[model samples]
Each structure stands twice: as structure tokens, then as C-alpha cells.
Target: MPELSGPRSGSEVPLELLRTPPPKERADAARNRAAVLEAAARLFAEHGVEAVSLDAVAAAAGVGKGTLFRRFGDKAGLAVALLDNRESVLQEAILYGPAPLGPDAAPTERLTAFTDAYLDFLLPHLALVRVSETASPGARYRIGAYRFWHRHVAILLASAPDPDVAAHTFLAALAAEHVAAVLPELGEQRLRAGLHQLGAALA
Candidate 1:
């Protein structure tokens, strides 16, 4: 139960577990968990989530299957960990990047920047993105990307003249339509155009 430190690095465990240890975890457990997450993310990004197995992740991580299961609980849990790792990076970008994204920009301007950044961020990671959508019931707790994007847009809307309606409308209008269908089928330009048009209309 390590707390995420700043915009740099740390673990994503429940806050309540911060002061409590299971009483059985060894010193190497932390290192092994980190390796498993790294390897799983790499394999899933390269071969798609369904294509990678628990055994493959363990092997790629240079750990045993028992260790992988013990660390993550199961394959789905491992996917959640991999996604959480990437989500942390995106969170860092939003919290610490330049103006319009990080802070100090107008609502409309921030909204525009967010759309552009989200499109760029989501384009290459379609594999993990799709897997995340299909992962769990309360996926946002693990995959914070969607919630982050929504909240960014919502914040921009709230800062504007009319917050309540605008924020809800903006989210609905901008959710990916045909672009997030899969890989290669949707180009960046097309997605960008859609986002721009939606942003303009909302503005």
C-alpha cells in the first residue's frame, strides 16, 4: 500500500491499506510487483490483451506464475495494474504540464487543449484502451483516463457561464463515436475534426 508520490512514481493501493502490511509479504514483493506490471503492459501493448496470458506475463517479467497470481490476484487484476500505471502518467501530464492543460488557462481554451491532448494520447494505445473499457464494472477506479478526460471537460464547462448543462452536453457530444472503434480504421485527422467540431459547438 504505497502512496503515489508527486507526478513521478509510486504504487496504486487502497488508502486504507497504507499503514497495514499483510504480515507475509517479503522485501522482494515490491520489486516483483513492479516488474510484473511493466512486463504485462509491454506484452499487452505489443500483442493485445487477449493475446497475452498470465503465464506469458510471468515469464516476460522473469517471475513465476505463482508470484504473478499472488501479486495481482489474477490476469484481469494484472491488466488493471498495467492500466493504472499508464493512467498515472496521464494524470501527471494533466497536473503538471504547461498552461491550458496544467493550469492558468481559460475554460474554453483548456477544453480545446484537453480534446487535442486526449486524441493524441488515446490514438496509439487503442489496445489497452479497448481492454480497459471491457475490463470491470467500476473500471474508472482503475482506468482513470476516461474519468480524467470527462472531468477536464467538465471543469472547463463549469468555469464557463453556463456550467451544469454545458458540461453534460460537452461530455455526450465528444465521446468517441466511430473513431474509437478499433485500430487503423480511424485516422487521427478524422477524430481531431470530430473533436474540434464538438468543442466549437459546445463553446
Candidate 2:
């Protein structure tokens, strides 16, 4: 018999419950997830993120409401899912790809490259990025991506007297709301220059 962790633990629960799903179920689940994502993307693209609902997504995907909710807990979850592919690609480049983004360059160069890459990514998906950031109070800082960025920045700032605080300040300057507010006045060129300058100062 398997050991139990608490009085409420179920020692009689079937072992199959703890095991991976059969291949067929796994394939079906994958297909359903893809279909839901595709449907949500198309709906959001045509109608805008604010205008579309999870119910609408479920109907569009031909999946049940329960399935949609189970797959993505809420609209914010859906937004994160939509951004995941692009985010993953950027993260991969940062961690493993060449030049200033990867291990091939100095820490300062990598930091500059990261800021440039992030700004480029943010500009194109301004609406989506904003939605993801503002999902709830302090939501942006709570996300996995935010943590990853913070850690990366902190590592690059290792020589700083207070790396954590400096990292937070650096990232705050690039917050979606802050950028959106200043972008029109500063223009992309000025904003990029300002970010590079900030990075240089931090370094």
C-alpha cells in the first residue's frame, strides 16, 4: 500500500489515477487544446480581446463551456496561452540562441539585446500585452514571464549594490502601462534610445 500524507488522504484511490493518460486520450486532448486555442485566436483577432468572451470562444471552437474553462481558467489565462508560443521563442533565444541574447556576449550586451527584443515584442502585441498585464491588481508581477525577466535582469545586475531593487526598477520602466503612456510622446526611436541609456546606466 502507498503511504498517506494526511488523515484525509485516500489510500484506496486507484493507481491509474496517478499515471499518465493513454496515448489515445493524450492525442484527443492535444487536438482539443489546439482547436480551442485556434478558435480563441481567430475570435480575438476579428473582434478584439475585450469584445470576445470565453462563451464565444467555446461556441467558436465547438467545445463545451466546461472544456473551455477547464483548459483555460479565465480570460487572463487565455491571453497567457495566446502569448505563450511567442514568449517561449523569445525566452529560448535569450537562454540558448546566439550573440548578445545568449551566452556568447557580455552581460551588458545581453541586457541591451533583451530590452530591444522585449520592446519589439511588446510593440506589435500592445493590446494583448496590456490585457495580460492588467488582468488583476499586481497581476503583471505575478506572472511566470515577469519572474523570468526579473531573474535575468537581476543576474545581469549582480555587481549592483542592490541587484533585486535595481532589477525591479529597470523592469518597471518598461511596464506596459508606462510604455503605452510615453510611446506617443517619445516615439519608438526615442523610447528605444531611452531604454538603452537606462540599461547603460544600470550596468
TM-score of each: 0.69, 0.83
Q: 1-203 in candidate 2: lDDT tens per residue?
A: 22111112123332223222222447778788789889999998899888999999999988999998987788888888788778777776766678787666777898899999999888887778888899899989877677667767776766677776778889998898889899999999999999988987887
Q: What are the clashing pairs of model 2?
A: none
Q: Give the CA lDDT, 0 to 100, for residue 201 in model 1.
A: 69
How many residue-pair clashes does candidate 2 contain?
0
Q: Provide backbone clash counts, one per model.
A: 0, 0
TM-score of 2: 0.83
RMSD of each: 7.4, 10.0
For all candidates in order, the CA lDDT equals: 0.60, 0.77
Question: How high is the lDDT of residue 171 in model 2?
Answer: 95
Best by TM-score: 2
